[model samples]
Target: MKDQIRSLQRLLAALSSRERAALLAARPAVLQQPRPRTLHQLAARLLGTASLSRSALNLGEQQFLEAAVAAADHARGPGLPFVCGRRDLEQLLGVGRGVTADRFAEVLRSLTALTLAWPDGDRVWLHPDATVLFPTALGRSAHGRPPLPAAAPLVVAAPTPEFRPATGDGHGSGAAALHFLDKVLGAFTEPWPALKQGGLSVRDVRRLARILHCPEQESRLWLHLAVTLDLVTERHGRWICTERVPGWLRTPPADRLAYLAVALADVQILPGLPTQDPKLLNQSFATTGPSTHYNAATLRLSANYSAATLRRTVLDVLAELPAGQAADDGPALAAAVHYRAPHLFGPYDPTKPPVPPRPDPYGHWPKPNVAEVTAAVLRETELLALTDRGTLTDLGRAFRRDPGDHAALRAAAEAALPLQEKATILADHTVLVPGTPSPALAELLRDACDLEFRDVRTETHRITPGSVRAYFDQRPGTDPQQLLDALSTRSTTPLPQTVTYLVRDTAARHGHITVAKAGTVLDVRDPVLATELVHHRDLAHLMLRQAGPTVLLSPLQQGPVLEALRAAGYAPNSELKPSAARAADRSEAMYELPQLLLPPPRRRRGPGVAAPGEWLADLSVDEHEPVGELARFIYNRAPSLGANDCNVLATALGAGTTVHVEYRTPARTHASVTVRGPRLDHADRLTSAAGRTPLPLSLSGLQLVLAVPDGRGRPVRGK
Candidate 1:
């Protein structure tokens, strides 16, 4: 510090006497007194020309930040930190009761995600660098925060008899997760025919609903989860499962549940919240019509807001309601969801290409106002059990921290899974599971048996001849009795005699009707399709010729021949011949998960190195040209006036200011000149009292520069 002071002092004293007079006259503005920088200047400096670059903040995020800064500036207390309550933020944003403090938390979460802000309970603390955005807080009054209201003694209140917070079994959601993979596998087996906009049609969802035994709305949610998790993807207008399903099937229930829960914050069923509102599907934004239902389900609060925002909003809402006060299921959280994302449920007329967006087709249709986001939060936290309901089970405040606790999520999924793996073997060669199976077991069972029925509570399967044959075919060299033995181990009762007979009988007759491509002919013997082929119009063009009573020949290639047979009255199935070794490779590679467009994580940058000064200290050269060191000193070591120094010049521009100037004459004599009360302008150049000429002090025909207060603290109205 002393060295810095001495360096500044030396620089100040190096000036010539005459130059000092001129500088003294011009330097009073800076010397008058130290003052805070104006808001405009600070904003320009801190925000920078490319301030928004590399920042993930969307329009909503940016708006939330500005609102928070404004709030911080207003209620700042004397200290290194500034804190604001949830209520203060609401008022600062000029919001109503409809905008719950939780919504404001959505904004804070975004800021926290960026590491720009953090929250403690209801109070928030911003990164020190963020303070530059609010220059008005500089040198603020040394006044502390006013004392908060005294804590009131607790008073016991009578419990309400009517309301009870239902403990979340996650039966619906958990079952959806377990069943979602099944739907994807079904899609993979038979791809979903996609719409022009690449969305599923009503028929597609209805089929899944029927199969999964869920409502169409819940089915759609499951499909969305599949897409969001990248377990299912679209290829050539058809939805197909990815290569990762084989791996996903083996994952534990907790992990699967964690992934499913993660997906909830993914595809927003309703624009408002994530509650199971019975009428939620009726909402406009929750449309299953097309992808345009919600403006874009890609938008989410967690990705946009900071963890701090979530914590603050949650704490504030709970505190305001009182301890143990339950707000579940209904409109209790409608206000908060509305405030957080007002445009969420609003009408969204997507800009369909080839059609101008100025006038909208669904203009008359009102937007969907989702009151479910809060419900989803309540569901996510599993916290309503803490509020009003004494019957509530313990689910620690998971949302009060990072990305949410996977432990709680895992527990929910495990608890929902049926523990009884035993099955009842029926006399008719069918199996009935008393309860739902975990995804892993379900997948294993699916490999050996054909699923007959599945609902929220039960699952049924049958070991048909075809399923037994398929099980053996996939395993390649397994004995019929071996699979039967495994089945016998799982069944509470003995395996039925008919089932074993069918399995043995099917294995004996499996290869009896072999169809293989022959030279210049597609041949099938003992199939009895010969008479049908001869009379079939589509087969007529294939030039089919009867080689024997049971066999027919066609000149068409294998693919075309198969197509023609199917075009006629035949059900042709393709089996990969050993000659095609690549088929097995393709089957193995097909299950890999599809990648999605997820954003990158937040980035942290270290402070940058200071740049060298632009001005040279001195320039001299000798005839021998040994001036390299001199040049280096002059250009590299020299210091230039910067931000702090600019303040000195600004001080001289004060109104009614006066300064004495020292300038070189045309004759080059060391003579002193006086310019009275010259105004220093924005460019850091001197403005003449006459208001016509501008002077660049260091370069305005002056050999040296120096400044000291002259007629200090004075401002000239005009010359």
Candidate 2:
């Protein structure tokens, strides 16, 4: 009894109120069968007791019996209704009593916290006895549906939990940690406060741990690694990632080569920005400014070689010289350096000192052969200099300044009578071999000679052969017979000729085209014809007629026809084509021979009359029209005919009467026939091959000659 009550009290204290009620409701068969025959019996059976009591069982003993009864009752119906609950529940089961609601509530709260649920509402109902136990408010309502049995609370089967090996903090084995850090650093491009935070909080650590599936401590270690690598900087309580880390990590090797090429070319590297040039750290190398030479070399290497080869070339070039020597090498070394580190050489300042010279691994240094190249450079430089220098010498400078003739010989040649005419005039003057003057002295001799005879005005020259002869006769100590000999000596034709020397030197100044105008008439200096025109009356008359009354004869020979015209007495003023004579005695006279000699009056067509087909007929005496009119006139005069149809035949002859035709046979050979037609109707059928369908024919398509027949029966193809 007291023992039972004490046991129940302990059980109630252990369990939640809801759990207790659930246990009491599931009455076992032992509780229901029969109270043991005596107190000793009940005690022994229920509590394994050896003594009996009259008072109620202790709380412990009471709970033991209640649990036993509930188990038995559950056997009759089902097991416990809830897995966990309170003490008063046993009182309602008839096994024990005197439990409080607060205590019961505490039990139920524990059961609920453990996530147990009630099966039924408010009370626990027994199966066979139909006994019901009302629960305290904490155990009254169902919390949720009862959980499945397989998902019921598990007992700790093994004494000790299974051993899990400790993961070492990320000091030595931190590949995953390092990778995580890399990712974190990779995300940031600029300095940010989060990264610089001193240590991770629970949330931060848990987040990193969840991502990595590792311990929080390990995540903290990875972050520390990032700070050490200089990938990120710690400031205040956050991490600030440096910009260079991402650049170094993300840029690929191939992109580096492309960057180098652009840098060498002095072109922009990044979008919308120029590359920066850094001064070389070394001073041993000879420094030359940006050399187009190096730039070109870099371009060629980049284009022709693979990236690896180019990289090797660059490294090799860098290796060949002393550490401080690259500064002196200038753009050459900078170009090589550019191949390896493009981002480092943004603006490519040529004035900067060069990078240290790295030694060549292969011991083979490349030196450009520059002698010929330098020569080419020098040549271009000189040409540019000369262009800037302008022309040399006074005459050349004058030509450069004003660009007129600056050479004595050229000026002399231009001043002379044109060389061709000069030679002719010189020959006529008997100053040189008649036609064999030398080209070298020809111009000079022409300039030396001047016309000796002038008429009263002293402006016009007679230029007669007699005047020339007279001038020669008057020469001091020279006979007329010897004049020719002296003239030959002066001309270029005679070697070592004294007179020739004087002529060559002096004529250069005076040779010019001779112009003579007399009484509204102009004449050219003609040494050949001057004497003939002046001395012969017949020749003068011929000249007037042939050259018109405004005669200007070149003093050269006139052809024989002029002489004949002079003999006929046709003077310069005679009318060439005469007009008709006036009527005699005020009456028209028609004489056939006289009329034949006179031009007929022009005739025009009256209204409605056909226009003249002949162009010559339409002409006003000598006027001309298009040549087509002649062709039309010729086609009108001849008529010939043959056709399968009379309609076509009639069409071939217009009222005026002539037609010409050209036809092609079935064999494709051409043939001609003349046709007379009045209109063009049905001509297509006439021209069609003997058995073929008719095709339209145009007169324009034929090649034909037509003419009217003359009285002699000859084809009058033309008048």
Candidate 3:
């Protein structure tokens, strides 16, 4: 047991000062004891019970340590300097049954790197105090379970509802990305109103859900992504499309999906926000700060892994599974991830037997644990088209290999996307786009119609009088014939009469009730329509006064009056073109928080005491003053140790090399001595060849010099 600590001390002593500092940085508790000036002190601090207990060893590493202790206990001969051979331990742990050679080797490397276990050539010298954390075979054998063999295997069969490869209309993430962008373009055609504080209210979310033709949750995800990518931003407390939208439209489809995937993965919860809100996932970036209605306790434990790490880990797990096989669902994926890395996602009580995680709650997997988080990210991957029908696509494979390789992601995304751009105009006032629509076709449809429903591979647009009137109001005096023509150009079938009549009638009625300056008067050509506005719910707050049968008085500004009428589903035209104002709104510069560049590292001041090199360089040695070669060597060397550093000294001691030392006299300031065949009495002290005098060596100072030997086993005289 004493030898184990001694061996560890020698190994630690072998490290350079920088290496020692780094080790301490990695394990802070190792430095909590009185500042260690010697290797023995550092080793003792590292091997202390507090440090050992807090090591946070992973499952595989813990198992390996337990097996090593068990193996050492059963050793037949020569166990004083206890060391466990790699192969012997592997066999005892049934490596092939549960652990792979690469995995085992990696575990060993980690153990050695932490200094928890020292590498002794082909064997490992376990820290004598490590057993305080691991149970011996005798302890385990009493419970009818020895700790020698490995535990659960890394890969497990995914539970049933068998893995099925996605097969559908040749549509995937690329198609989905295009569809999402198209909806964003249409939804932001008008600036969305913002409440006094907080994100879209439930009513607002439902409205957006109606416009995007998806569930509230899915709609929120889209809005979140749009905000994160800077395609949409708040202006005057209302969300509107940024100037980047045009540039975004010009970006290639695949590149757009890649950009979205990257942004989605990078979304992080703002600090000081309630993470327990299930809606936090949706509004992590949608609003300034998010608050939710769900109880925090209803939410599962905080995620053990970050979104990016969890995403990458999920990708890796899928990549490792057999071709055409997936983890069935998020729980299966979670199980696989936990098996691969138990250190993350842990409730691992050594006192309790290991068991599977409980099934998640019934609805809204609020802020979830590892399993729930995995499931959520999996859905995102599906939306990104990285995974299809529970299997990785070409894009998924490429992304898994190199997420930063934008070129590859684009190419893979291009291949997976469906290219059909034509829509079939039905007689029932609906247009059905069979596959992903081109930007031109999508824009045309959104201009003349409302998105009724959308899916992975299809979209249905419904043309109505209200939609046409709204379009004409945005672009007054723009012939409704032009929009109809554009829609006709993109459609496979001719326009239906219902759509044609709806557009022409809506266009003719769009410009009635023109507002004058400050909207003080309303001149309406239709008395009944003007009368209807006074009773309309959306515009009732306007409080219009009937000055005459066809004229109404308003107290609001021109812009507010027009917005209120439009909100009431009336397309009231402005007296002015308003094109410049609309253009300015569209041209509102994208507001982005400037990225602060890190300042350059400051140059450290030189120590008060000059370094050894500067001191040695300044020394005025007299060349003709009869200084011996050994004395000259000491004069030229650094003030501390030279080439014979701790590593070299450790190697020489391990190889049992004969030595002759040229060292400075301890009692005399300007004197030196040369002794042949001196030996290390202990780790830091040397014994004279006569075995009587002991000299303590200061590793940090130039105290000892070794005699260089020739190939023929004799000391070589220095020139």
Model 3 worst lDDT window (10 residues)? 617-626
Question: Any idea how many clashes model 3 has?
Answer: 2
Q: Per-prediction count of colliding residue pairs? A: 38, 95, 2
TM-score for all predictions? Answer: 0.40, 0.13, 0.46
lDDT of 2 by residue, 1-719 (tens): 22232232233345443543454342232132212222222211222211122112222222222332343333333433322222334344332233444444443333222212111233322211111221111122234423222111111111111122222111111122223544556444444334221333335544655765545434433444444345565456454677667564443322222222222222111011111122421212211111211111111112222223322333333234332232222344444444333322233444664342222587322222122112222222111111111111121122223223324312322211112222222333333222212344332333334434311111111123444433433443333334334444443454334434333433333324433332212242453443444445654533332143334443322223232335656333222222221222123322225445667988764324222222112212111221243223323321111111122223333333433434333443344454433233354233322222234344433322233344454433310
lDDT of 3 by residue, 1-719 (tens): 33454566666656665555555556665443123334443454455422454236655566667667666655633243257786677677666875577766777766765666767657778865555566444255424544444432322122223355545322555786668766876688798777666455556666787977766556656776787788887788887889999888766566787777666665542111123544444442223223422233122323443456556766777777666565577445566655455554554332444343333576433223455555666676777788876667788888888777888877777767775568888888888988766656766676667888876678889887777877887787898789888778877888788778877887777788876443457888888977887767777667787777888887665556766677767787776568854654345423357999999999765324433333223322112221344333433432333333233333444444444332334542212233334444445455545443335543323333444455553544322
Candidate 1 lDDT tens digits, 599-697: 999866533322111111111111111134432332222222222223323343444343333333454323333344555455534556665443444
Candidate 3: residue 312 lDDT (0-100): 72
- lDDT, model 2: 0.30
- After superposing candidate 2 on the true structure, give the runs of residues whose Cα lies further than 4 Å from its correct spot: 1-501, 504-648, 651-656, 670-672, 676-719
> Arrange candidates by lDDT, highest first: which order?
3, 1, 2
Q: By TM-score, how accurate is candidate 2?
A: 0.13
- Show where candidate 1 strays beyond 4 Å: 1-173, 184-219, 243-255, 265-293, 296-327, 331-372, 376-412, 438-444, 465-485, 494-719
Candidate-wise lDDT, in order: 0.47, 0.30, 0.58
